[model samples]
Target: MFPTIGDLISYIFHVNAKVNLQTFGSCMALAFAGAYVVFVAEFKRKENDGTISIVKVKTASKTMEVIVNACIGFLIGYKVVAILLALWQGQDPVALLFSLRGNWIAGGGLAFVWGIWAYSTHKAMASQFIHPYQLMPYIVFMVAVWGFIGAKLFDAVEHFQELLYNPVTVLFSRSGFTYYGGLIFGALTYLYIGYRHKIKLIHMADIGSPGMMLAYGIGRIGCQLSGDGDWGIVNRHIKPGWIPQWAWAYTYPHNAINAGVFKQGYYELPAGVYPTPLYEAVLCILLFLGMWMVRKRLRVPGAMFFLYLVLNGVERYYIEILRVTPKYTLFQLSQAQMIALLFMAGGVAGFVWLTGRSYFSSTKQIP
Candidate 1:
């Protein structure tokens, strides 16, 4: 299991670049980038078909631009000049970069320049038409921030003991995130943002659902690559002749979590566990493709999103059977399974409601 880019590169090319980049974080970056592309294209397609209504959003107003851009400029100018000064003085630039050392004049000048440029840009675009997709960047940024917070908070709940032992470590750790928490929190944030922008809830959900599927698929690939302990219970079943053995089960040697028994300067599971992350990655990617293909055909407002929930719930519920998670003794089900069932039930009800609504409305319109 390769935890970092440096590790993977060393194994393949036998060279030490010593890159500190994390595999999971890099994959998440790619996931967001891919999602952004999907949003851009999906919104444009909806706009062209007259399905999306353009609203006058005040996000790019002169005051907003000036304030945000000035802060950005100040930070950039502060650290950059400090680093340059340190290098000239034969001191450690990296150390200075993190310190309070900075050139105030340079920072102030850049801040003014940045603010003026942003204000001018907004003023120039005042008369031109704006697309509804202009809100995508802000939506994505908010979702990413709050989603991470939610993921961490839920993880802390599940591992309360660990958090108590080392509060800072557990809270800030890059791993140990719960996906469902992020989904719930991010969805709430997305809804609020959509409301602020006057976007229809159903339309927003439909546009984002497929991209989210793709992002999740890509993220699971990271979990598998890093072996961050999201694997399944031990697999006793023999591998079929047609399938790759590692895909069926893996010992997860040198995992990012450094789990399993250590022996002879190595760490690995005594026996193989089912590679559930890989399974999820494959399933979600395929499902994303299917969703993308079927999206245009779904005439009902929220049908596409409801379909997403059903598909997501079904896949996760079945996979939870193989996964290693704490279970509720009463129901003999993991928390994820319970949530999955809710998603599936909600999806079915939503589909029924929306279909009935459209049918009744159309019937009433018929003279």
Candidate 2:
């Protein structure tokens, strides 16, 4: 249901071998390094140009100002976030925060990093605080929160059977992150960020639409490279009228889903179901092309945004048929299918509203 990037990395490097901490640590370090480089480059572009300005904290008082701002941010974020989680799951605030030993450390680290970054950036951009670019902080914050919370909630839902045995463990586990879950929530979170920024919601949506799809594809590549459990089923021989064995056939040694025939505590799926994530990633790239084109051609408010919703919904609904997931009811509908339907409705409604506006009354456009 959930896979960590570490699993794929381990499998790639040494199939049927243990994944050691040192190995994982090295990979994480590399990832962080690459991320920092990109962050710095973007920050500099904003800094060097007139888009954003940064001034050094020259005095002790200014330093304290930064520190206080950072602290206030952390408290506000933690308190509100904790309360929301508690409300959602009917749990104690303290219990939710400390459910996993790593939760406190990870959450605190995220808060600290974003808090300090926002404080410093805000101060630097203070002179132009009201500029349109001021929306970056909210966007970044939305991405982080949506990704983290969505992943957690999806995991909780996916493993409801396991949760029946130990609800607390299921809710708190650090291991239950689904990449697509995070992606979906992150996109929804952008709506609020858009409203706050005073950008027309659909305009803001168009800005991120292409990037969002591409970024998700990148994340899937991470899932594949890490060999987290996102892999498809395995089959010994090629299915009739399908791709040849040599082209698509590959063994996933010691995969938990496919390792039942291997030994105790290890499992593997029977070969050749579908490399669904890979297929999804490829389709996402193509979908991104459509989004980019529509954003360029469609000037109507919300048109590109609606296009994204419809296209993404259609893609996910079709892909769900090939993936292994818990189905609800006798109809065997998947969780993603439910979300896809919602997206499709939103898209259709938006398209209808935008195109049917009074401004276009003089020229009747064909459907």
Residue lDDT tens for model 2, 44-123: 44345443344222223456656766665566565656645554554434344444322344346656886677556654
Compose the digit string of candidate 1's lDDT tens values, residues 103-199: 8988898999999888877763554446878888888989998998889887887787899999988887656799888888998898888787778
Consecutive 10-residue window with the lowest summed lDDT within model 1: 90-99
Give per-model TM-scores. 0.85, 0.64
Each candidate: what lDDT?
0.85, 0.58
Q: Whole-model lDDT for model 2 versus the true structure? A: 0.58
Candidate 1 wrong stretches, greater than 4 Å:
13-15, 59-64, 73-129, 164-166, 263-266, 362-367
Q: Assess the local accuracy of residue 150 in candidate 1 as a C-alpha lDDT between 0 and 100.
A: 89
